[model samples]
Target: MAQAGEQAVGIDFGTSTSLLAVGSGVGPVDIAPLGRTTRSFPSIAGYQQGNLLVGEAAENLPIAQVIRSVKRAITDCSETMEISDEHGTRRVDVDEVIVALLAEIGTRAKAAGRPLDTREQVRLGCPAMWDGAQRQRLLDHAQNAGLPVAHSTLIDEPIAAGVAWVRHRYLQYGEQVEGRLLVFDMGGGTLDIAVLDVVGGPHPEISVLSALGVQLAGDRLDTAIAGEITEELAGQGIRLDGLPEAKTVEALVLREARTAKIQLTTQARHRIVFRGLARTQLPILTYTREQLEECFRPQMDQAIGLVWAALRAAKLTELGGHAPDKLRGMNGDRLAADIDYVLLAGGMSRVPYVERRIGELFPNAMIYDAAGVAADELIVAGLADPVGYDRLNLHRPGFDFVLEYTESGRKITEKIYPAYTPFYSPEEAWTNSYLGFERRGDDFPGPKRGEGVLRVRSTSGDYLALRYDGETKHGLRLQLGWNMLFKIYCDGQILITDGARQTRKLRVHQWPVVRGNGHAELVLQRVDDAPPVPSTAWYLEKEYAPPGL
Candidate 1:
């Protein structure tokens, strides 16, 4: 049994399936099984007679009473969804549904001989495209679910998957796996692809080169197969009867279709006999592997195209562009020799046809099937960063903090925080933290206002140079309907710029500094004698505005 202290746990809060695992401190990092299968738990939840059901129990419940793919609703900014029961249909908060599912993961963890709620630290994975609000909602749900989280972090799902792949390569081959890797994740609700560069060593580093996602995935294929089955049953004079509404019948067919889809992974054909469905015995729908493959052919092709697009977006492979020193060895559409492996993750990646297609596409590289490692367990295993397994880097920030102002009839703008400032570098032991922006005017000065304070530190570089990033937009935008202030702190000195000075410089001799917002450059003059440094830490002190006294 593991000790009763800080137990590191990682949870992959996926759209179709969710999983939890414990790291080395609690013996080997292993996934906590959900009921019978050591694979994954359905990301489903139901509320019946005031009793919440999650995972397998939720799956066993009637389709009308349970909610599946709640992750999609959450991403759409939906507050609640309607579910029917004996009392009638009622609306339930989306957060509550997510909380119930997460709570189930905690319960199952405890039943597996380990308790997740008592863990020292927990890291949850989320989609890459999720914004601040979406990410916060996930954290709020986790907390409400009563997961004992002394410390918590939300990492990008693809990045976490990359961490797991690197670790697996090291353990299996006893060799450091370096070079670029492409992760094709086709889950129930979303298909996302990410290109990562894994630097092998005692401390492996994973950096995201590019990532792309589409709404079409396993669920979409399931719906397509269901439609085909429906057509086939109609041809046999077997129509769904005695169902309350068409939606219920459609849902029932989809459920059975998903089961058939899973079976097609190994079997050449599947017989989806709809007996007692809709209170009638629908004809047995026979779907051959070829038929199912034909149904999803277009979607499969799109998924393959997405992989190439992601690769091009990462600049690893390109077409019609003059060859540069960076991407030297390249034939059109062919990946670079440096790309060591192509890893297929997520539940849909297990499809035999999909695996075969990916292998044929990347003939030079070894293709890894996620089934061996368990798709849902990959990200959770990445939470073991403290034990030398982690994504050691971050992609460039999408936006740049710029100060723009009108100077002598001409507008001048200066970038304060340039894109890619080494947010969460490999040497750093902790993740990067973003400055908080509140709704109050006093807390963050209006856009017209200039000069604010900021604190910053770096794991590398002597002088933190502020440069222009042509890639990001250059403008100021309010956060949550409130204006923001720029802060740049170097050592104990604060430099406030509001685009007034074309050239600005801050010297701190490599010491950690602060951040601020302004349009003018500040050059502090050395004095023969100055007041002793304030006893209180500058960061702890709040900016004060004196009353008109």
Candidate 2:
């Protein structure tokens, strides 16, 4: 239970929109209104006359002056955007734009009587495919915006949605209801899927078996539909090529395509009006659900294929095998039968095609969406609830941590920790291995007579090198441990009482893509001819503690 006077705030800083929710003690969470009648703020920012406008104010700005989907740039720290106004044109760092948007959100939430003070518990949701560097960048941005957030408070978006479902079920049944749930979250920029196993009772337990994501969602679908519209215009002798306002016309078409897509979700047909074309008066374009489905078929097929991939990942991990051939005998029937419920989340999940296809894939699973809960608010609702703050076990990292070094003129790679292992379980905390430094023959040609280099690498492409003295006759005993705060540390020591020991902590990085073509290396400074290994404190203070503290 949460302490009295304590508040839990969940901020869903999404690519299309941002939302805020607050919960106190055991009460139901409430979504704070950012405008007179809307609870969401558009995730966009615009520059005008040396001033910045955010949310609804920025939505009306010219496409060239406004930056949409600013959250997607966090993956690349060096990304920049150019925005021009009547005054002049300037280039701005993407991080700066994100910070401004977050600060504005904080201001609006405060004006709505839900200020995010340092004393209140706050959590931010991120895409499941984000690596440690991306996550850290978001945490820093939230801090700069004056939000009460820390590393431990960051929750995966799909997992947060699952938490919302679990809490809603608990309330509906007046008791805990146990089952297996598969959460499908397809938002503006990405599609995240998580398989969760739940045990219901007064104290519910939720474990994420596997999680996966891909950069395919509502935004891509809009682009496809817009392309189809462009073809139609080209056939009508309305060519936009070489036109003065070509970019503007393209943007207008995309905007109309997005609007039409949303309308087609609940309507059979929608009419898109195109006005202000240079010297051309075009006829009103009518788009139907059938045409939309034609444009969506390829993307929808890929999306459903990804769902099967996620389920296969979970099954293979449960079987404790890493080889691809391990799944030769497995089929979809057993996996589909195991899923008791399929929870749809995110704005894209509202599409009727998505629901119908998912229902076909999981024949025996119940497709669930809480009666009154909006798809966009699911993540925030779960984030604000204290019930899942302490009981939800996140999915283990999907990549392995390895040690790479040269031995006898050959490169040797040893796995220190395998993927899909419980990160928080005490039984899997410590991993022990031996680091041999023997120069068996001249062919071995080890590092220098007094120096050696050992590189610790994660499959996701982040690595750190350790330089140590090679004079010790006995090999070093290497111990790697996953700490409670989701960090990995390495301790190397000679087998003697007074032997010198070196300890280094490496932050774990995981992602679906290989970052920078495996060039993301952490360089350590050398001190007195040896690399310095600083010890980090593993304890959390009262204010920095995670939820349920």
Among these predictions, the greatest TM-score belongs to 2
lDDT of 1 by residue, 176-221 (tens): 8878888887787777788887886445766666666777788899
lDDT of 2: 0.66
lDDT (CA) per prediction = 0.59, 0.66
Candidate 2 lDDT by residue in tens digits, 207-255:
7766777778898999999998888888888776655667667777888
Model 2 spans with C-alpha error above 4 angstroms: 1-6, 25-27, 75-78, 82-91, 276-280, 319-323, 397-549
As a whole number from 0 to 100, the lDDT of residue 362 in candidate 1 is: 78
Model 1 misplacement above 4 A: 1-7, 25-28, 36-39, 88-90, 117-119, 148-152, 237-245, 276-278, 316-332, 335-338, 370-372, 388-391, 398-446, 452-498, 501-549
Model 2's number of clashes is 0
For candidate 1, what is the total of clashing residue pairs? 28
Error of 1 at 389 (Å): 5.1
Error of 2 at 71 (Å): 1.1
